[model samples]
Target: MRIRLTDVAKGRRDEALPPTSLAYASGEARLALAETEQRPTVLGLIASGRMAPDVGTVTIDGRADAATLRRAVALVDAPDVCDPAPNVTVAGMVAEELMFAGRPSNPVSARRWLEAEGFGAIARTPVADVSPRERVALLLGLTALRPGVEGMVLVSPDRHGGHPAEWWELAESFADRGFAMLVVAGEAAAIVLEGRAPRADAAAGTGTAAEELDDLVAGSGGETPAALDSDLVDDSEAEPATATAGDVAADPAARDGSAPASAAEPAPEPAPAPTTDPAPARSGEHDPIPESADPDPTPEPDDRDEPEGDR
Candidate 1:
């Protein structure tokens, strides 16, 4: 099964929802790791017809409609979404669900279903009494009873406190039976997808399907697949150089509507200043005057007898 989400924006980032855009190609078991509470778990709900995306389209196998999506998607053990009453007995919950769905409502039939799934021992136990992992497993077992479900979305399986590998195995088991699985988990989740590969276009806008889906759930804007592809292309090519305000003000070429050289030429060094002799100090000065400053005033060329005596 293929699920694609286009420019979908929802919820407020300030309130823990960020705008997002992305495309997701589903695997047998896929993992959506999110840093925030908004995750693919919400998308699973939208896909299953429980909630509507504020914007954008949710298509399964290239079709979008309530009846089709509802029939094909199922939520398993999603806390606060699909989880049954904690105090409800396993058999009791199953019987009620079957009755609501217009299926066999007999508690005995529900009990038989549990036994067939190797959960007979917990048939009479209240869900709250079971371990978190067991609770999730039982919920999954119940989900299997729904007819014609082609996809299962498991939300925050890590909250149940078990190896992510265990959840992966469970998802794969469902996939082996031809069901597509999506596991929404935290960054630390231990999920392992079979045949998982890095998307070549990962550099494209939208970080992950979960983040983009949250963007939709948070009521943000969404983009079509084509627009997203274009964004990827734009990102790959280097962006044209842009001058900052200071640069533009400083560069004459920028002001003249012409591109300046990619690299600016270094400025020429300044010439050294000329040296000058200082004036001689006056006779009454207190500070000592240097000999160069005084310069012997041309020695008052004593043309007198001193010249004859020395000669």
Candidate 2:
């Protein structure tokens, strides 16, 4: 998928570039390379047909009927494969996608294809009931099943599949079936890159574009994807308890809004608590020990028998 990033990130100059060119092309490639937690989602429309630079044309076979160029490459357009209306069954939707892509036509053959990709069970289910990943996974499997596809392009495949082995096995299985692969990941996760093509570099420059947009949005004004990297500042690894206010106060450049106070600033102290000992109830008016100015006074014992003897 080719995503056009906006102004939101500006501080990703410290990121690393990849070793391939196609890595830079499939759209999400650059984001996969960026080490920073900060990033944007401006990946431009996917041009999956074949990277034709001179023709000024980028065609994506992953799109829906080729009306718009903004479709994702991998399972990008796969999630929306089924119609929202009850016009078609979930299995029927899968079959239609296969047929449109020129896969097998008859339902029996299509079901067999679905069975191989672990999709036979949910085939008749409504498209609305299926989870997002399930839909995407079906498409991922379909790409694997479809014969003569030659090479396949995947956009942000990592979002749907977490472990590298889960998708890698599929790619290996597909390659054994004679299909090429292109995978788009959120990060430059090499383990997932196992079976993909004459690999291309994850566009390191894309991170720069994202960073510049991020910084611009953060500095002046304009909408952009939230800075993923800056938000990472809160992690225990980046922040310490002993981090005095001075460290935060020193940098005006870093503070987009109001700067924090310096160490010289007075800190509010904690209030003291009342003691466990209880106080006496209110007396007549003023109750005090005669001839006593001290706060703590000793009480004298009553002598009723001595008073009676004196009388």
lDDT of 1 by residue, 145-188 (tens): 67777777777777767666666677767766777676667756
Q: Write one digit per residue (lDDT tens) for candidate 2, span 1-311.
A: 23221121222341322222232232222223233222111121222432222212232321122333322233333223322344456677777767756777678877787787677888788765665566555665665444434445545445444565555455545446444444445544554454543234433333464554444454434554356445545564665445346755776743556555556568998665456853553543234345656645555644532444332
**What would the C-alpha RMSD of candidate 1 be, to one decimal place?**
17.7
Q: How far does residue 36 in candidate 1 sit from its true spot (Å)?
A: 3.9
TM-score of every candidate relative to the true structure: 0.56, 0.36
Top-scoring candidate (lDDT) = 1
lDDT, candidates in the order shown: 0.62, 0.44
